[model samples]
Target: MPYAPSTVNQEQSRANEGPEAVRAAVGRARDAAPAWDALGHRERGARLLRWRRVMARRMDEIVALLESEAGKVRADALVELAAAFEHLGWAARHAGPVLRRRTVRSGPLMFHQRSTVEYRPYGVVGVIGPWNYPVHTPLGSVSYALAAGNAVVLKPSEHTPGTGRWLAETFAEAVPDMPVLGVVTGDGGTGAALCGAGVDKVAFTGSPGTGARVLAACAPSLTPVLLELGGKDALVVAGDADVEAAVEAALWGGCANAGQSCAGIERVYVAEGVYERFLDRITLRAPEITGGPGGDYGRMTVPAQLDVVRRHIDDALARGARAVVGGPGSVVPPYVTGPVVLADVPEDADAVREETFGPVLVVNRVRDAEEGVARANASAYGLGGAVFARRGGVRLAREMRTGMVSVNDALAFTAVGALPFGGRGRSGFGRIHGADGLREFAAPQAVTRRRFAPPLAIQTFARGPRDLARFERLLRRRGY
Candidate 1:
């Protein structure tokens, strides 16, 4: 299969090597896991820090590759690179404290016992990452997995195999001994092979439908999986919100990355009191956004997705939704499609219900903040969202059902390294950031020890009726 950069002028191709290559890579990862884990947290962290330095030195090259392969604008590519860098650094710096053994109370019933919990590696991890935010998305899992002392085998999207290979190469440059990270380039079949290759666990980022297939692939081994799937994320604009700021956010959040982001704003629910004003502001700003090479946004990375985008727009328009900016005619063939803003779109319309992975936004007026929150939550997805309100931002945010919500801002929660990122319902389960992400790649092992033997020996068969009576008395006193 041939692959081309966003410009479509230059094309390159790679054959899908199938299952054999995937198994070989996974075997190497399995062999390397023990030595990598044996390095301990400090040495592992130091190696990761060196990897970060290498990434820093190669940021420009990585960004260029992202733009060519993922159809991302320079600014957007830089943003993705920066986020990946932050996650890598944060994972290295905080892994020791987050995964270290910690003492827990033994409780009154077992006062003589001491208990502790430690996080241990899961051997090897299989990461199946998406094309959009390819570097950042996979690294979020890979970095944390490495910091937690697990070897990683990554199968990046077919649209971005080069980016994946670059990452593995740079990692090798930093730590030459042992294959701490491995890359297997192929299509979906290779990804499936990795899932069933007996990797300790799998971390997948893609659509919910694909996520289900991945789940099935890992079923026989009962391998645990962490899924970060698609989202039809909503943006709620309260009556008291700053209409201008909200519109600005809608423009960037909805159109950035050519709207391929899983957490990108797909639907906007504005309180009726400020609906017209919000629309006016967005209309004024929408004209400035463009899509092409070296434009505000780039072409759709995946060619098949263009049909889905077109169908969503056409369906909404035929159903009486009016476009305030781009309409059906804005599609520039092959891949490029500018931002489209639709008003009065039905809640059941595909544009609102399904994830329209394109530069499109659907706006619906709500009766009040209560109605806005209700409309936003009335979806199968509960991923990321935004609530723009001055006085009630936090209150309204708490009412939303998504995993992460930015108050008075869009996509801000993802920039901070400490916050956990994931979703519920069809948006998928598990997390891949912060302390929770580090623990996701690890298995928690609990240890308990007796400080001193109890006077009544419950374990010994020698103790008969008197020992049983004493144990019962202790239970009764503790109200167990």
Candidate 2:
């Protein structure tokens, strides 16, 4: 069947101006940063809260925009919007304490003086977000940056320009007088310009390949960056795992958002004893999941990704793997590929190695829990992993090389508002969400004010022999 070309224009043919326009937006953001940053946290928080209300009131409009641009189900679009709203609330409520100066206990000698650390905002932050979870990912950066007192210039993925437009419109309603946030929509050139446009920092979310380019662009400016990149996360099913529970988790974790999520599980390593049964159950249910704007799944957001999905499927079949449920023919066209489960896929196969950013899963048997852990860790991308062990969920989760691990459940690590969210190695670095997210846009400044003179001078030209002997003895006793 012929596929429906993505409603979104990938070349950003429909998107307004390329790099030059984005550069101008960045200039405006940089010009407005000082005034925005000078506002008190309470005032800033009120403006953010107003935006939050705007998001709540216009949920339907936002959802519709999201569906057209991203091709995700209406409910799924709402879910992303809700998550973005939550982060906005979280940042606004917590920013004051998180960024305020706090007294630090100085050791004995320094106790005579008072010391504290305060966090200051970077001037401007450029946020480059992905098409998948467009609202949540971009707002994750935008909200935190605003709460930390920095002006933000956002570049939503070319495939999801409408979502970006909604976000900017909402903010404009909340803080009409303040140029707190701006949006620039385009393809790679706009994103590249944002990185090099004299922004104090950059926050990017997308594939690792694109992340590499973002890193290189920011390197020349020595600008710090927070990258939330791709992952080929794994789900490790230990021998002790409940078969029904593990299967349910693996299916949803791998297929949710049509498997477009960076933290979604693409690989499943089950213990040898239950491997066959697990694969059978998952494959059996894969086809029933459905895909469309009205259904649970939806059309592919990027038309080119359909080709990538097909290629991964073809590669797996050529490597002797069989799709127990959906095959190439099962790839329901018009930008909607139904769920597919592949068994006997070699570890080295492209399907298993690359991020098949579609509803596809690769199942492999492991000798034991040890093998399951090893296979999960073997991937170059260590963004996230899941463990379904009955007695050792926490321990097994800790052992995974990824930055986050879900125990007894898939994607649970993301809902916790307290945990820092990020990945390592090829999955990318820096964080969003939790306390770390708040700190990402701010720099810590340590202040120490001298009070009275010390009994023995350390930094004076009139230091005596007794003072020198005392310092040496203290150092010797502490083994310094």
lDDT of 2 by residue, 50-141 (tens): 89998799777777777777777866776677677778888888889889889999887677788999889998899998998988888888
Model 1 misplaced regions, further than 4 Å: 1-13, 335-337
In order, the Cα lDDT scores of the candidates are: 0.89, 0.84
Residue 402 of model 2, lDDT score: 92
Best by TM-score: 1
In candidate 1, where is summed lDDT lowest over 10 consecutive residues? 2-11
* lDDT per residue as tens, model 1, 1-480: 322323123222234757887788889998899999989889998999999999899777788788778878889988888889899999998999999999999987677889999999999999999999999999999999999999999988888988887888789889999787998877888888899888999999999999999999999999999999999989999999999999989888898899989999999999999999999888888878889865888888988888898899999999999999988887876554578999999988999999998989999899987898999999999999999988889999999899999998899988788889999999999999899999999999999999998777887788889899999998898888
Full-model lDDT, candidate 2: 0.84
lDDT for model 1 comes to 0.89
Clashes of 1: 0
Pairs of colliding residues, candidate 1: none
Q: Mind sharing the TM-score for model 2?
A: 0.94
